[model samples]
Target chain A: MSENTTASTSPGVPVEDPTPFGWLTTADHKRTGRLFIISSLAFLIMGVVLDLLVRLDLTSATKFVSLDADSFAQSFALSRETLVLLFLIPAFLGLAMYLVPLQIGASNLAFPRAATASFWIWKISAVVLIGAYLGNGGPYGGWANGVDLHLLALSGLVIALLLGAVTVATTVMTLRSPGLYMDKTPPFTWSALVTASMLVVSLPVLLGQIAILYIDHRYGRVFLLGNYGIWERIDWIHRTPQLFIYVVPVLGVAAEIVLAAAKRRVFEPLAMYFTIGLVGLFGFGAWTNFAITGEGADIIDGLEGVVLVALYAGALIATAGLLGLLGLAVIQNRKLPKISTSLLAAFAAGKLVLTGALVGLVGAAADWLEIAGRGNDGNPQLRMTTWVTGQQSVLIYGAGLLGLLAAIHWWAPKIWGRQLNELLGLLNFLVIGAGALLAFVGPALSGLLTEQPDFVYADPNATSLYSNWVDDTGAEGLSALGVAGTALLLAGAALLILNLFISICLKKGTEATEDPWSAQSPEWLLPSPPPIGETDELPMLTSGTPLLDAQEENEEANT
Target chain B: MSDITPTLASGRPQRPRTQLVATGFASAVCAMMMAGALGFYMARRHASGPHPGSDWLDGLAVPNPQFDYALLTLVASLVTAHWALWASRRRDTAHAWTAIATTIVLGLGFINMVMYSMNRMGLEIGSGEYQNLAFATTGLALAIVVLGLLYIGLMGLRSLGGSVGQRGSTSLGAAVFFWDFAALVWAVTWYTVYVVK
Candidate 1:
């Protein structure tokens, strides 16, 4: 047993880790969620490590590292892939699994055993995916069994994620307390519903693409797609519009954190839901195909193209709307809200999401203009350039990871019944925020200085990701700037891993009081880290802010 | 805080619709996957510039008619699935058993015919774009059908234990929904790849 096992939770109760067998087989949503959270964070370290390698490799134009271009290709592909698939997406999914039911006044997900199965499959498949990379078989590897394993493992991961999404979505749709209809559920729960729905629709498209990639690769017939630019085709999951799905949760999560910190009721909760849903609506990136649409296809030249461009712009507006509403609530607080790391992280998350959206908007508009035959040139050629990487970093690193940090801080007491070291959380946020900006701005500026394609071919002449592009400045400093940004991101990720270790294992921080933040959601009604909240009786919720309503009732009773 | 804790637990649980909702959501996922795959198929076919015929599977023998038979068998399974749902709801235990067994056989028959069609086509994997897609699209459809079969089989076993005798069993409805979804997708695929060539 470790020190965390003997940690204090409630006033007299002790928090203990479940027995090994119990943890593995348990259908308890919270336990399953814990498994997801810990594993994904572990994956986060690997992703950042690979990124550091890529950074070092890219520090110069003519190969900074001794390894071949193929090795760096694998590094580039795995770095982005692991961050999104292995870390951010699963981490947020775990958050939903752990908190959605509790927020909606339920005990477990709609299908508890299936949820357990999903998590295990995800964990095993994640191992296989990483193992595939380790065994010389990721994106640009030799035609080996490891490559097939990567495809099959990816197929399994998609299935697991879809199953998990169904569980969360079903729970939200069916298991909410009787009086709490969809509209009346809390912001986080609503966001989970929207997020799960988006995943259900968008992820299947990826599965569809993967099916072709897998079958082709497995059979050794790359006739349809001979080159191992497989990552280029499927990497749309990390692209502009689709990548926003991961950030949609940030908008919803920020609402919950702001409400609790402000101690003020959201005057327009429905508006909040609409904006959240709108962001999710555009995040349905199943329609955008990088290979076809990015090449100035007919889809971009017509009315469909205009509508799609408008939708990308719409996503940015929704992010702005969400930030404005949240800002007002905070500014209007009766007294100054407690200045905690969680609150600060929430603010920073908003700014990052907005920044990411702005970058995405620029990319979309430029592509639209060029395809519509009204552009001077594809200036700053966002596709296949570091410009796209900049947008991805700001979104995935800034919004997704930072928002997750904020949520963990806000809900740590409720999750583990102990507070994280607040000082460490603040440092984590600042370091990561600075890293996100540098990662975005450096590459973005570099894109303007000269043409540095993010995905470089090993042969260098076998294939070109961008068909129409002329060298702008042809300079050398762009690579170094990108390297600097990558270094900062790696540093920030390392600090996060250490902070989590100390908080979860070593510190055994102060026990969390019930209603730690005067939270309005149903989760706050339970004892901090209660075993299965659905078992607890709760007053019938008439609105999103159930706790606030209950407080008024209590005041009336006392009077 | 102590006084409010009591009222917090006062809310009562409602009838859960999880089973049906989950099945419905799963069905939606299957539908989207098929749609996306078919879209990919069409895009690839068009990209390859082989518009010699309407159906992309132009090289295969038309008189073989194996895909036609496979699609028919899957549609037939949907009817039997609906019958089982109806019987289970009416508490006709014997008809429910018969209907479920018939549905299972049809589901198995559909899978057999699909594999048999693949065999009859004699298309080896890794051959080219057409052959690879032929296996993948059909294989994915077969997997969805197998998933429905498992759900139907599970619900059928529940009927023997009399839990499914309860009126409005969502499990039965869900199984039927999944089967119906499987058949619907197969029909669309049948038209796209097997018909109109």
Candidate 2:
């Protein structure tokens, strides 16, 4: 247990170098992790700002940012900022691949060289993607463009993936003390493993396809074009299996976070086995829908692709079972000895459940619409589905915004080592969530109306986007509620930015020396500023709570 | 601290053989599905009298001059393996260093052939149906080749520590023999298919 054992920065090693160039080139995980978190926050703010502008524009067709039919078309077009942000999320996700291992008690990643390569690849790809935005072709077209970048950017991603996958697998295999076996690993680490496996299996196929596309773009070759057509090219290998590639690990991360924050374990270990099984099976199944129905195919066929639709339905049902465990957790939180910080996390987990359930409900409804042959032309279910899918301005701007807010708050401490003021934190949540929820309500209800009402003729300007609700209320109470909600949401969103900036500036310096939550994981076993190499002696663990265990060990040694 | 002998380095943990087997089977199945696609490509080329090379496979096309290259690559692989064994037996640093470098070069050259062969086939991204499949399969092949490169690098690192002493060196030699044997079998299969047919 001597501090001089290993995994320590040489005492002579400076924490942060004085020279600007040296500072910039340092690959020290702590420094990189900080940069990653800060960059992610910047992206978050940019996304939220653009979203609010788009929402306000939607609320009134002739608002300051006009939304005429042609304008709508232009709005949907990929622009410079849009492309940058689009690439940024995965870049941050890649960054997580670097930072998370260090946070989880490993010295260096499993493959240091590959880890370095992954970062360069992502950074270079970002430059290329952003450069393409300024180019005349408008950065390829549609999701295909995303794939195009995937091809150019894949070598780095593969490098990152290998390093990441090895780090996770090795941590599971070798890094842990003899006592911390498969069953006893912390929830977050468990999630990391699942995410790692998905990386190994899923991303490779996607990268392969993208690499093919990149070659086609560079040369005159037509991998997905010509007599056979692009969809057929995809359908041949993974007609329906591709969706799980993106979603399986997302669900894994979500499940683990929800359980840990909620202070609950998964209802059954076997449940995860089912979850991964279904993910792999349905991942293949989900992609097939795209094949039969075709990508960007009609809403009806998208709704109807039975096998894909059914798999999604089954997934939703299983997720609901998982959510039920979470719900029980919220109730259980009432009994647990709740510290202020843990309470903040617990509250965020509570909102996560509600948001997740709504997402599932929206998806199920979309599936039912396809099954019933009712689509956006007349059916509400179909309209809702179309809205919630990534394309809809409302769903993307709304649901994703809220999810980002929740995730930011949950990870805020680990990222920065400081807590937001409790009051401001609550205020931040209310404003962000309420803004997105109101936007969702206004657009969704406006969408349901289908035809412009006679009342619009009476007073066209008065009949805003939520005119139906106003008309339903006979021009009085509900319209007032809608307006009030809109005002609250918008003002709240603006306040959120101000609040975060202040929080960042005012953050307590000394707290940076403490692991924020008294984290029960290996991450907190080291000093607040972890040593460059890592801790000297591997921290011992009796239960799953290594940090807590370390504290007791220190006390015993002193006694 | 006393000449700080490295802590008894952890043994290579056993993988759930079941998971490994499952992934291996899945990978094998996928590879076959792709190989079956080669038949369609060959058939189309036969019927049409000429076929455009796939974009992904363009990287794999070894030039005619490189015919001897594969053989030389195999010899280097064997020499490196033999050197590793010799070094381990003699406890010689030079033997370890030589073996590690040669093996890496051989692995890189082999990987380059895979790239050249695929690129030559024009199995570029977005190439129509058959070509896309070819690109994906070729990419998988490159990934495997990359793993071999990684193995050689790991061996080099372990060798420096003298941990990859005689036993490790012998195992690596055995591995090289197996790889060369496989390469011969592949050469035989290629001649049987293209020349005989």
RMSD of each: 4.2, 9.6
Q: List model 2 lDDT by residue over A433-547, tens digit each.
A: 5554554454434433322121111122232433343223222232233344446645654564555566555653225433554444555445444444333344433345455
TM-score of each: 0.91, 0.64
lDDT of each: 0.74, 0.43
Model 2 spans > 4 angstroms off = A1-23, A48-104, A139-173, A221-306, A330-372, A375-385, A388-414, A438-500, A508-519, A522-526, A529-533, A546-559, B1-163, B166-197
TM-score top scorer = 1
Which ranges in model 1 have alpha carbons more than 4 Å from their true place? A1-17, A220-222, A227-229, A291-305, A367-380, A457-478, A532-539, A552-559, B1-14, B52-58
TM-score of 2: 0.64
Candidate 2 reaches a DockQ of 0.13
lDDT per residue for candidate 2 within B116-137, as digits (tens), equals 6546545445534445434544
